[model samples]
Target: MSLVNQQIQLVSRPMGEPTHDNFKLVEVPVPELQDGQVLVKHLWLSLDPYMRGRMNDGKSYAQPQPLDEVMIGGTAGEVVASKHPDYAPGDPVVGMGGWQLYSVVDGGQRGMMRKVDTTHVPLSHYLGAVGMPGVTAWVGLNHIIAPKAGETMVISAATGAVGSAFGALAKARGCRAVGIAGGPEKCAYAVNELGFDACIDYKAHPDLKSLSKALKDACPDGVDGYFENVGGMIMDAVMLRMNAFGRIAVCGMIAGYNGQPLPMANPALILVSRLKVQGFIVSEHMELWPAALKELGTLVGTGKLRPRESIAEGLAAAPEAFFGLLKGRNFGKQLVKLA
Candidate 1:
């Protein structure tokens, strides 16, 4: 059966903050599924900060989206029709499907579209806690930072998907986890709900030096591991308190993603403290996904790991959700429900 699909395309690249004019929503006919291909009806479309980088026409860890292309994203969907034997109709899977109502993907491209059992948790969790963001937190923390018992770890963007997972995992590993968020509500959620030992409000504490002092006060033991998310002043603040032989896992720089000029880096601190600061993309640690999923799923199933999702209904709201994510308006995982 032929299907009508609506997709949001990048109309223009933004200089700093992206406005609605940068996106154009268009309706088109869904392409026919080819051999070793499947037609998926997207259920949940994730709006992550990393998407901000893709909107620009620049070289980065991933390829930039060409002008007028459907915006790239991770999507959870059900297979409506399958030309491939590995996937059949009604199979729920997750993969790099664009922001559209329907998508057709070949078997090779659909390798990331692993079939999921929705009975275990809500299908949305697969896009959040059990998905890329969750895996990012797990792999980066476990493999890179490797926080030990009694160590102190600090995570920026602490209420969002990856940051939330980092805080929870750090606490589970017997380390003191401190979260840094934009507002009081998110800070409360990070501390009370996510079980972070303390949460700092960057908005409230605008001065990086003061924020560093506050963070150091909360983490009297010194910051052993830093999960760097928003990498502007917050990063500089956290760097001030890095303990000797500290490890920094640079997951993202949401603070600089909106075409901002790169800030001056202070290599002196790294040199003085002998800090091991490394940047990584989730794709680099795909081999460890099985282990991450098992641990994250078990934590969620046992009520230890809690995911808070800010879900926007309909594909039309996706652009707004994307804007909200960049502005720190999202409470947790920002998602658009397309199905």
Candidate 2:
């Protein structure tokens, strides 16, 4: 079997917003599988906001994506060849296949690669709702923001992969899930399609006072929990409306990801409201994945969690698609289809 692997590598680090110059796409021969390795032909590559953080060389929870190496990403694909006893060719699998059309993974690694059943759920959902993003939403909501029924839970980036999944999980726990998205279209989808109680178009309310008023109107009982995605003004607005003993799960700060300053407008509110704000990296909680995946997969299989995808056609489109995701240009989960 002869196969050439197409891959994208990070050639440079971005000072501000990433430019195309930072990435270089090239081709290489797919390495022959050894004793315990498996060859995976990536079908769907996930583009997420966390990847932006990995692009920077600065120290973080996870190691920075090395220069000249495959750009880091999650991929859902099918095994093309396997020397591992646990895997076989044609098995649907999920792993960190990176920005490439193919991957050679060591099946012996504890959590590096695993086979998946795509009968009830689509293979792509494993990269979004039933994969990392959905689990992120679950971990933050359950472990951090632990909301009670009848409490108001708000999430920014409402129509995004994590927020959409969070909306479903929050609703399942009987909390009033409110959403904050960038446009009228996203807001409409968040409310009508994703089943949020109300969704505020943050674009319409661009400033603190305006956004705070909108949040107040949508959440009449005050915000008992917040799943933060975008930071700065939206967070400031939420801070003003947070109830005593409120919880905040700080997920992504996309607003400041491009080197923008993201100072909270009111630090005193934290003390006054006595809010429990926690920032988490979901990878650290590997033990909870089975439970999270079980709930998320069930949600998708049962048609309760309807995840939308804005798919880019091929491996080359990943860069542009990721840029669109950072700019709020894509709807729902952003994925790249290699085949």
Candidate number achieving the greatest TM-score relative to the actual structure: 2
Question: Which candidate number would show the highest lDDT if scored against the true structure?
Answer: 2
**Once model 1 is optimally superposed onto the true structure by TM-score, how far is the C-alpha of residue 65 displaced, in angstroms?**
0.7
- Misplaced by over 4 Å in model 2 are none
- Superpose all Cα atoms of candidate 2 onto the true structure and report the RMSD in Å to 1 decimal: 0.8
Which RMSD values do the candidates have, in order? 1.4, 0.8
lDDT of 1 by residue, 24-82 (tens): 99999988778988888999999998888887877888888888889989999999999
Clashing pairs in 2: none
lDDT of 2 by residue, 39-66 (tens): 9999999999988989888878889989
Q: What is the C-alpha lDDT of each candidate?
A: 0.89, 0.94
Error of 1 at 265 (Å): 6.7
lDDT of 2 at 77: 95
The residue ranges of model 1 lying beyond 4 angstroms of the native Cα positions read 108-110, 262-265
